[model samples]
Target: MTEIVGRLAPSPTGALHVGHARSFLLAWWHARSRGGRVVLRIEDLDRERVKPGATDLVLRDLEWLGLDWDGPMLRQSEDEEPLRAAVAELLERGSVYPCFCTRREIALSAPHVTDGEVRYPGTCRGRFASAADGERELGRAPGLRLAVEPGELALEDGFVGPFTSDVEREVGDFQVQRRDGALAYQLAVVVHDARQGVTEVLRGRDLLSSSARQWLLQEHLGLPHPTWYHVPVVVDEGGARLAKRRGDATLVELRERRVDPRALVAWVARSSGVNAPDRIGARDALEGFRLDAVPKEDVVFGARERAALG
Candidate 1:
């Protein structure tokens, strides 16, 4: 039997909001049910946006929720060297190249495409040959990008059923390392997941688009792709997605309002249509939790739901 491993990777930019709490709970419950290990990883590679003491806040929030992780928690900033090595291997195999095109250049070059993101135009694909000197300068400026071939990338999502996306058409060639000499999210997540022996991925549906890029990198790096489960995202009253930046529905706010942790868990379960809001105790909630019971429709949080738990 294959080992079932899962992780809860939260960026230390702000307090973990209710949406984050739901996602973390799903990851923890899934791993606990399978008797697998749950790893807590801090995705703080975006140094420019990371907040001071945010990591501590995340740890505190998880502890407040009564979630325990095995082993020492991992940080993306500490694993840059390994990701650099993985990028080097891909470059050696002619699977990646240096991209010098700016975001403005790509947008101006392709006006018909309206995905909002600038899909790389492959400006540096054949511009430079892989040189030994170039490999030594991996950490320097002018980031590297994976050359995505034209094809349909498909995967079976545990909750969402079968999903497919065309990489070259949707995302184009994506970055492994940013032009500012930072490791890209796609690159770091792929390498980290493989290194940690993660057999399953439980994240929110907001990241569904990114799974295609991750699958592409996993195939290029010769790493095994894990099964995916994109849980429904919690939204605000206006139907907008809840974010840590918004400061609305954050765990910190809930705690200030005198909300209990178990009640919060029950609230999340009830809001997502997984359990009753009146439910008490962790074991009762966990036993009542069902991945299939999660509603496919987006759940909007309001004062009434918050009152239901309190």
Candidate 2:
């Protein structure tokens, strides 16, 4: 049997919050408990949102929680060769086409879905013969979008169980590369997962929709799919998901208040349906870790939870 490989990928767009803590701790527990190797990857490719010194804070918080990973940490921006190669391969295989539609144009063409995604209507599909043709005709650079086929793609998530999605109907042809020459998240994540030999993926359920599109890319690129686990996400009292931009119960705030990291770990463990002491190390909570025991509903993070952490 192949050794299980997992990843702790965090975007340095903002400070780590309690919501992030829960997800990271669960991910750490899930991998470490099974004696698996966990690779750390900094997803800072979104230069527009990447915060200065945010990466250091993320590292600091992870260390504070005693979430250790194997091997050297990777930055998505550190290497562009693999990303470029993946895009090139897709282009060569005719799996993708140039998209010249701007954001505003796409938005005006359709209403935003519940997940805040606008199901792309294949606006630029076959609109141009090539990237050069798109630029020549539109007088601007063109992004690359996968020519998604219309059909349902099913998957069995390690945690969420059976799931299905039709990328074409849900999101249509999605972009692999942006017009600004940046590799989109879907493409970047697939390339990184393949290159790092990640055998399992455990993250927030909010990204569950992405698995279908990623599966398509994997098949197109001949890359293997990893075991998927889309666990529940932490939301505020109002049921709104926490965002780094909102400064919602940040770990930094807790640290400044002298809140014990172990306390936070205990809270996370309990929230995930595990019984833990008032203060417990992340590793200590892994003794009888079971994925099935984790709650399927979104975990609430509000005043009561914060008070408990202190």
Scored by lDDT, the top model is: 2
Task: Give the worst 10-residue stretch by lDDT in candidate 1.
Answer: 131-140
- Residue-level lDDT of model 2, residues 1-310, one tens digit each, is 8989999999999999987888888888888888889999999999999999999999999999889999999899996799999999998999999888888898999785637898888888877667787788779988889999898987899998898898888888999998888889999999998888899999999899999999999999999999999999999999999998899999899999999999988888887878888998888999957778998899888999888776
Question: TM-scores for all candidates?
Answer: 0.91, 0.97
Candidate 1 lDDT over residue span 47-157, tens digit each: 988999999988988987888888888899987888989988997898877776666767887664625566666776776555334445553346788888898977789
Model 2 clash pairs?
none
Cα lDDT of candidate 2 equals 0.89
Q: How many pairs in model 1 have backbone atoms within 3 A of each other, for residues 3 or more apart or on separate chains, i.e. clashes?
A: 0
